[model samples]
Target: MFIIPAVDIKNGKCVQLVQGIPGTEQVVIENPEIVAKDWENKGASILHVINLDGAFGNKSKNLEVVEKILDTVSIPVQLGGGIRTVQDAMDLLDIGVEKVILGTMAVENPETVEELSNKYGSNRILVALDSKDSKVVIKGWMEKTEKNASELGVSLQKKGAGGILFTNVDVEGMMSGFDMDPLLELLNAVDIPVIYSGGVTSLMDIENLSKTKTFGVVIGSALYKGKIDFIDALKYQKIL
Candidate 1:
């Protein structure tokens, strides 16, 4: 499993927010390309790049920064946030994004996942299943859906999605620790690999997560605020 680092971009700057809020940024830094490169240099095999402007229905022209990030990092980059349609996902893949993550689009237009997967191959498509209180949330977690998380996972898997990016919205950015029960439910429900996010606080969490069937864990606030060491996490992932 890969211990991926998040390089979330908002207004052309690299920032990490509390539960993905607009103004509650916990960490902000300039030159997202440098941040992406730093993570690559440190040991990240893949990077999670997000376009907050696109996800939140804002207009920040984040694609410029995303392009810079893609040009800066050699490691495979999996990008998400604000991908609204199949063409957008396809265009990014054409431009060299290793994988394109779809959240709102995947849920609203399930057939698009099948189209993208069929065209780009399933390995190039990832569907985000952001969950809150066991229900799926879309559009940057601002809106909630009546859909159950695991049930959606099964549906997306059936739609030929390559993997799932399961973010527990309830605990995201809290820096406490994630509950394993919910994660296990999704893992048992779907056959595709899942990369978990939210509430990843320490090395113990990393070790425990590494032992599970999770594809990888996306470390955001905890890793950014120094609650957990990225290199140490990488070492643990390799050792296990």
Candidate 2:
């Protein structure tokens, strides 16, 4: 499985949020460009970049930082948060993001995802299904939806989403280890590539997740907290 390092940007700084809460954020690095370059040098295949400001409704707040990271890293960056329109996705793609991850838009405006997939091809479009108790959440995990994650996974795939980033919001940034049952269920429900996120605390968690058919796993708080060493974890995954 691919080991992707997450660089979540809030207020133009690289931060990690606990359970998607704003004030619960912990700044990991002052310069996101430096962090992106370091991760690239350490053998990260792809970097996961999220804009917390965008997720909270302030969409344009982090574009400058996002641009810096893109300019600094040679590796692909899969960006998420606040990408609500096809024009928004296109603008990012035009600026060199390898993939754009859609969560709220995927749930609220699947037609936009379809339009993007058709224009850019599905490989460049990823739909994020953030959930709690297997029900998908949107608007940065602040709003709960009646949609089941597994069902949504299949629906997004049908809409031409190249892949699914399945994040369990309950465990996100908790450093508490993952709940495998729900992850496994979502994996089983989707035929396309599925990237697992949330609650990865140790190399053991990666080892266990590797047993599943996930395309990749996003490591956030665990990496920032030193619970898991990025380079070492990549080596353990045989990704380096």
Per candidate, the number of residue pairs that clash is 0, 0
TM-score of each model, paired residue for residue: 0.97, 0.97
lDDT against the true structure, per candidate, is: 0.90, 0.90
Model 1: per-residue Cα lDDT over 148-230, one tens digit each: 77999899899999999999988888887989988899999999889999999999998998888988999988888998989
lDDT of 2 by residue, 134-188 (tens): 7899987878999888988888899999999999898998888878988888888
- In terms of lDDT, model 1 sits at 0.90
Model 1, runs deviating above 4 Å: 238-240
Clashing pairs in 1: none
Model 2 gets an lDDT of 0.90
Name the runs in model 2 displaced over 4 angstroms.
238-240
